[model samples]
Target: MKHLCRKVVAGIGIMAMCASMAACGGDTAADGVDDGSEMTVEVFDSLANYQGEQKGWFAKLVKDKFNITLNIVAPNVAGGGSTLFDTRSAAGNLGDIIIMGSGNGQAEDVVKAGLVADISEYIDDTEYLKQYQSAIDELTATANQESGVWGIPTSVSSLAPTESSEGVEPTFGPFVRWDYYKAIGYPEVGTLEDLLPVLKQMQDAAREAEGTDDIYALSLFKDWDGEAMQNGYQFPAFYGYAEGIGYVLSNAAGDDYQSLIDEDGQYVRALKFFNKAYQMGLVDPESTTQNYDTMYSKYKEGKVLFSFWPWLGQAAYNTTDHKEAGQGFMMLDIDDMTIASKGAQPNGTSTFIAIGANAKNKERLVKFVDWLYSPEGIQASGSQTNGAAGLQGLTWDVDEDGQPYLTDFGVKAVSGESVTVPDEYGGGDYTTGASQLNVSTVLNKDIDPNTGVAYNYQMWDSELAKRDTALDVDWQEHMGGARTTMEYLESNDKLAVIPGATYSAPDEDSKISAVRGQVKTSVVNACWQAVFTSSDAEFDQVWADAVANIESLGYDEVYQVDLANSKEMTAARQEVKEQYESQSQE
Candidate 1:
């Protein structure tokens, strides 16, 4: 690997150089290739938000820099299943660029099938990716590659592997409209069940005050579900449990494991909780059929009262106007719950980016992929997903003292406010003009070498200084001056930090994969049915029938495999925890 040419300069210099290069209107690509001829790269991105041609600012950025137009093929928007992937794989091409989950055996499967390219020969030409060589090697090894790099893992962190990934907030927990909760006098919620009555009162108050019929305490969507109902699976994590394997929930401590279908397990309990919400008219009736986008719209309208993730309701509703008005979602403590927090992933997250083996313009494609790992690429493309500040000189910029600050446009854009972008950057609202790939190459919490701070704008010194809005002040006071939700949880010992480790379950054999697929379909269908059941009897019957159906399909055999995998994961996690403890003691 010859690390000769640095395509990007350091820090804000990279942005300045790229902007100047684009302004020059030269016919040469960044890598010195002829740019007179343009190429449209087909991107099969499982995490993409838009399904067709890439547009807006991101399109312009790539076009100017690489002379490439991205044609995104998103399975998420095109039906949300393996159908697209299967069809594409059968046709002898997945796409020029492939982005998908690495944990489900898909990444390894593609490597074995020769669907993706080995980019080891080209890695030396990349500046940023060289720093992530360890991550690339780990992923390739996982794919059983002896001498070639098959993929680059997503969300690679610069932090030590022993540290927790969680920054200011845990990914999952209960977040509710602060104004309504305060209006109700902030009643004590001692348990999961106690949250129901409190939510009901809040919903009633919101409806009466706003004179709207659409208000609901809970709103859910089914688009993200896989082997089980994702919404149902979230509740268990709030109680220090997470999915270890298919149908298996493991506690954060990685000691106990339970089948999701067990009568008394957290999955069923979550279903019952939703059923109770439905009976109390606190759940949105449209929850069953709606997708995430639809549910997000409801959140933007203030129709939904509670969210299981901080990103969801906060991203959609926490605009400057709303926050200033003291009306936005904030973390509400559930005393009995120990929220699960994800630890830092030094080996990167489960998702990965790979190039097709038969991709057109192989060298150019590799160059483009390499750029995605660059600081410039991380800011430009990552702004849409991982909370990186948008393009320097546009959404954000460095001051004379070299401190990063969000511009006026960025201040509005980062907070989910609709702002018109300049025509030079692609004319449109900031949200729509954002990159549609919806995947991140680096973790937002990773420290930028240039800035000496996390890539996330929220952590920037400039952004932090402006956090004293009415909503912030009120929430801080209510939480006893806790600076952030994570601080509040940690102060009260209500958070369970899951250690980050590089362990993954071995890919299931053909027989096990078939059985697992059938089991997944049955479990998902049954879970949804139970949530919408009219009565306790109906819910019980649904669960019983699902168990019987899956068992007949060899559920027990699959469970044994999953159980073995869970045990391995538990051991791996314990090892990481022990290593961290030892380090701290030193």
Candidate 2:
């Protein structure tokens, strides 16, 4: 650790923080002597009012641990925006830590710039590390090799779920307005052929109601988590039908785990279906660039009939709307997950956060992280304590007669539009951080104290159901971070994670990524375009060309790497499976 620190300091080339900045890291761990001072930067991320009125619990924890004052940075970057990242990197005025909201595209850049430390050395030693074996395995597989350790893998237990909710039905289904579905004489959407007509019916309904012919049936956006919620879950659910069990299984029939772009298999079948959908107006034509805010507009404004949306807000909102219009709202699982056209699979947590090299005290930070995952940690970070924003003065402690009594405001909030929650929260006030630490419980609940609305109730409930129903699905999920490299691999987006384990960078990975950029997006898009045209000649030509480029773009070596790594991992997974089976037999 000491040698690595020295190397980092030397590699970073003695451009120590300015005297003023150096003054901030008071008593915090430093490479050199403790100058009896500490440094702090206004760290920022996705959370709103993230500072929690200056004395937030998170802040207090840091302050107590390092004795450094972290004057919480204001103007919290809204929805994982770029203001903080750009500001910090440009001015080199980065804080002691820039906790990225998720391992989106930023992680790649963070690794490449050598701006963070490789906290991997401490992973095996941390008490909580054992609980996060799978995550560590995945992190090791995807991380850049240059920094070796990159960021510390946050052992956030809840966010590290193995599978998501499936609802009452067991098929590849998500929560839709099942009440509305039943009322509408639920159509036969058991196949691609069925979905296309339903999309048409939706388009026609939109045309009749809104008089806009161009308004699409499905609205997909790629920002503000657009692509994820939009295509990531919804499309795959449907796409897997034609693609078959391969979509959910450990490997396609003839392919290895890393062979995502093996066009001869399930993916190609799925792509052809997607191509058909694209041509038949089921998918939004202008969907490639829309953001989340824009995507929700179509749903909220009633522009389309059937679309994928969060059952929680959508159900609550629709119910509220019906009350206003003399009707009620109801949501259902829509019998989709069961009517598998293609496959069934696992859905994990929302996002990933890795520790920054600049984290003032790395070991302490890891301890703090582990503490957060403890029952108490989750409760404190959760809505129970109203976030790490401020002090949590309210409680649901049981009162006389054994009734759980919340504060007066909590009682009054029952009749209000939303539940009223206390402004004061976090920092050892209500003391949820010291409570029960059930990671699974956290995944199953996202209760908002203020609104009294389980905003994530549907998401959680649906995910829970998914978990139960998928007990027999022949599927294994490959989980890791790959956003930036994905964009770089778009033409051939399937080849994004072909490398086994992680890439340390400047060696094989850099080489692979550069070549991938050339053959990714454009090549795949072109092939799909030709296929959609239904021109056999064009399709054949494009397919031939894509295959031809495999060697030229270094895909041959990439494919070989995929084979070697994928076979090993799959074999290991199978061995584990057999071992479990044998143990069960005993």
**RMSD of candidates 1 onward, in order:** 8.7, 11.5
Most accurate candidate by lDDT: 1
Tell me each candidate's TM-score: 0.83, 0.54
- 1-586 in candidate 2: lDDT tens per residue? 1112112122222223332332333222554544435555444433334442244444454455555454444334232234444445444444444444222233454555444555666666666444655445455445434334444343223221112222222223333333333334546565544565655664665466556676665555554321011143343433322121111212322243423344654444444555566667666656666665665666555543444433422433344433344222222222232222211111112123344544556665555555554443443444432222112234333344432234454323222234323333333423322222111212223333443322232222222233221211111111122111111122222211111111121223657556655655444454445445554455556666766764476655555544554455444434433443464579
lDDT of 2 at 60: 53
Question: Which consecutive 10 residues in model 1 have the weakest lDDT in total?
Answer: 1-10
Global lDDT scores for all candidate models: 0.79, 0.38
Cα lDDT over the full model 2: 0.38
lDDT of 1 at 200: 98
The TM-score obtained by model 2 is 0.54
| Deviation from truth (RMSD, Å), model 2 | 11.5
